[model samples]
Target: MGNTSVVLRNVSKQFHRKTSGPLTALSDVNLEIAPGEIYALVGPSGCGKSTILNLVAGFDHPTGGSVTVDGQPVSRPGPDRGVVFQEHGLFPWLTAMDNVRFGLDVRKIPDSAEKAQYFLRAVGLAGFEKHYPRELSGGMRQRVALARVLANGPSVILMDEPFGALDAQTRLSMQELLLDVWTEFRPTILFITHDVDEAIFVADRIGVMTTRPGRIMTELRSALPRPRTYHDLASAEFGRLKEQILMSIREVIAAKTE
Candidate 1:
């Protein structure tokens, strides 16, 4: 991993509407993501968290400023940045194995089947390779989605509420799975979520964003010891940090409603 994985300088995004007028989604958003670190953006719904991810993934262009990955401006989607969206976005017709192999196939990688299987196993889906997305459980399907992105060997992972659809138990399990995968791969991750605990548990740095026309309100470094486990959440220190974040977020929410 390199020193700095991504940088956004004064980035802003505006969506032109036909009747409602221009929608300012992001405003002067500046952020830095260090290599091998997990940085999360947490905010209320419609606060433009996904818009930030879209800009980084080049799914959409910023109306102002710049977004750079590995020192290069992001102009379009590339294999260097892999995205896992809330919707798995898997091909319904393709089997788990084929889904993971899709990126490799697109890149014309030799022996893509072998590489795909390796990633399937890495994400704990080895035995379900032949199963199509519809045949798999929601959690299993998401595992395939995550593996597919990882198989491409992206330097940065952009996740937009990837676990939001799962049930509580499944969500917790997926979080642990993500931690395991992240510990091993150490890819720079920018995860966007509405869940406060999820952000605190998963991120090395938590960025709180204000409501629409969103700008970063505050950034907090997680000083908690790493190799974190569920037990850590019960600790007094964890509770204190969680309280602080909750307070900050609540303030943002309150201000937006007023």
Candidate 2:
């Protein structure tokens, strides 16, 4: 799929429950992700990071404003956009290759096996094709999950805390793998994460959000250089960006507490 741009304009979302009145998940949240750019959103929990992703993913609708992709309004989920949650979201009964093949099969796309296998290899899971989710480790399962998303060839990939559950080392490895995959496939990405370091490491630009009535507080364009490596994690610019994001988060939390 060719790269495409995503735009969220004055987006706001409110959820109403019978007993709790109305809760505002987002308020006047505006965001733009350039074609093929990796944009990460970092915010305190319940700050609507996932809410923003959901809106763009067409899983939910905003109460106000518009969500568009390639200048067209997003009304429902489409093949042009793909989403990967923190959970692998793979079928336990399906083999790695089968899970990757599922979407293509549903869409009636031809050459499904070939494409699925190719992506599995791309994610470093070449020989594990027949293994079920239960047979694999956490990191391996995630690799399969990622391969599934890429196999579909979406122009935009929306990730919600995709690496949050992995151990630190595995998480780092997946981060590197994601960059490698991005470099080759070049999909516009909106990544949601709570880890400051992770946000700085993976994003081309990182957006930090304010408390409760979530909205972007600031956005930092990363300069640590790409085809990112663990070595970049120690660079001064990385540390500087990390600290800036952390301070912003702290301030948001502090304000919430107050």
Candidate 3:
């Protein structure tokens, strides 16, 4: 594609350690996501999956190279990029609609309340608008969190294990719901997850990373067709991709252990 939505060129990030020299988190990592494409990153713990996410979200700066979205360098978090962390990060006292409305209100978006309601409905939380975060189930709270992001109408949606906390069944439903939202809004998504199946389920391409000083070991393009269902998870092609990713991850970990 001539125009890329999210781009990271030779990106590297390091953090100063208390007792040692700088700790490298990522090294010379490069990734490009086309507009409306869903890209996923999967790797072992401490492999800098979240580090890559934070870089693009503009929550942190890289030590070298560049991070850009929509052809512009990212210096700080902006409304153009929406992020959903593993935790729902909702206000405990706020109702679902209010939680979704919070961002719109912060941006001073016109008709904030109405936009919040519409997004809540879009995420299948129509009747739960009045439910407080404490009153809602884990899945519902996550739905509200997702609605809040969608309401912002971001060009790039950055997610770090957004559904990793849910139970198996709830997580499946949420995965399906995510696909529906992606189809409707078509925001370029950068998803970071520990689950290989989840990555295959939601991503157009998946990058597997090494254990430390995280670098992409390989990238796999999803061959499974979209509007994907759990039934598709049983297909030979899905199993093949999952097997390939798992094998790659295992090899990396095994090499480190050896």
Candidate 3 or 1, higher TM-score = 3
TM-score of each: 0.97, 0.97, 0.98
lDDT-better candidate, 2 vs 3: 3
Q: Show how many residue pairs clash in every candidate, following the order shown.
A: 0, 0, 0
Model 3 per-residue lDDT tens digits across residues 1-118: 3589999999999999889888999999988999999999998999999999999999999999999898999999999999998899999988898899898888788999999999
Backbone clashes in model 1, listed as residue pairs: none
Clashing pairs in 2: none
Lowest summed lDDT over 10 consecutive residues: which window, candidate 2? 1-10
Every model: Cα RMSD to truth: 1.3, 1.8, 1.0
Candidate 1 stretches greater than 4 Å from native: none
Q: 120-184 in candidate 2: lDDT tens per residue?
A: 99999999999999999999999999999898888999999999899999999999999999999
Model 3's alpha-carbon lDDT is 0.93
